[model samples]
Target: MNEKRMLDDQHFEQMIEEESICTTDNKVYEAPLDALYDTAMHYCPGCGHGVVHRILAEVIEEMGIIKDIIGVAPVGCSVLAYNYLNIDMSEAAHGRASAAATGIKRVLPEKYVFSYQGDGDLAAIGTGETIHTCNRGENILILFINNGIYGMTGGQMAPTTLPGMKSTTSPFGRDVETMGAPLKITDLVAQLPGTAYVTRQSVHKPGNVRKTKKAIQKALEYQKNGDGGTCFVEVVSNCPSNWKMTPVQSNKWMEENMLPFYPLGDLKKPNGKEK
Candidate 1:
């Protein structure tokens, strides 16, 4: 596995070099493959994972820490993240991404570590690991993608699913009376003394995309400084296929519904501020 990883790295690096474009002004622009592999992604049409992956790769490249970063991905839509990200990656059992990331960071204190998880994996089955990891101040970043429903598992309801949100498991829409209100895991963790940064963001708009990237960049920087106990970023995204809406419709629905419940902005900041 190690040998294969090295070979893959070398191959992708070579591809980047070969694809470099030089302008007449003597400036060279390299292809966006420094931290992301060149292969096509497996996410569904209009999925947010592809956009998020690109920004992550850009950040790793900008920070020049491609070799020093490790990512942990658990079961769900992002389970194949290792295949997309060029950096070293580990696959954990469902909802165990935080635990796996904690171990990796502990073993390699010098390296930057993060976990990429979806709503179901992070807010549902993995809730225990996620909360405990944050409370323990694990010194790692947790990238939470909350689409409100299980995108890869037949559109089942998730812990983050909002009231009146329809899913395969909640055909009549989520009922707070019996199903309980949607979990604002980001807000829940922000109150923990162990968490140094907590924010909710999205990528449905160009401006929001920039904010999300900045949030991720800041989270990683906090980890680099080794001051923040835990940095949690929640990206409220859309699930077009599972929601039975066109890519355009999902984004519209998300704006009208998801954004109102899981508002975008920082819930906690390292500078001792909350919004």
Candidate 2:
């Protein structure tokens, strides 16, 4: 069984590296390979949460460890991830997903544990837990969805909110003087020795989506191979509904505004993990 699992993982790695999906000449579409149940997502139009979820599910399925995964969700737009992701899931109080995930990992150390969180829940209220968990070198994956504004709480300014960006709470442009600059928490966490990998990415385009998947897949493989540290994947996404722009406009705004501040790239990579 172990040898078969190893072979399966190798097959997946090769398939992922090919960078293209092959199919028949006829265009017969099917639901995503990892859609465990027939349920629709509740995300607003152009929201990146659903795509991120699907990517995680795909990686989990490819790794052949679907049953061995445990997902922790925080109180934000993706609070109901358990519904869409047909896996063992638990919900944490607002900004407490990291804490809950810590306990879950400690108890069920054998399972592939991860926490799905939003910028508001992770960078602001749960800053302490986020720091401590990474500081302690917890062996888990942190999937942080950083969409500058608080999408779940009616477009409030999040800790990651870019300067000159407006939200319900900040009608005028964000005053960096008063609010402080947008927090690059990913960089801050990378400074800690306990963190093994830190990469900021986006799923706004097809090529970016593929890179994001590779980032996640690499992070998971690193974790599985006794890299005793935290793997943080910060996804800089867009909030179209809160921004009051169409999906296309919102994406363009992100490229113009958000990318300038939260540039997408790997901030840190541990020794021997860079490939």
TM-score of each: 0.89, 0.87
Q: Please state every model's RMSD to the true fold in angstroms.
A: 8.8, 10.7
Off by over 4 Å in 1: 1-31
Which lDDT value does model 1 have at 10? 72
Clashing pairs in 2: none
Model 2 weakest lDDT span, ten residues long: 22-31
Top model number, lDDT: 1
Q: How accurate is candidate 2 locally (lDDT)?
A: 0.87
lDDT of 2 by residue, 1-275 (tens): 88776787778888867974555554464345663456778999888988898888878888888888898999989999998888899999999898899999899888888899999899999999999999988888999999998998899999998888899888997899998888889989988888888899999998988899898988888778746588899999999999999999999988998888898999878652442
Worst 10 residues of 1 by lDDT: 22-31
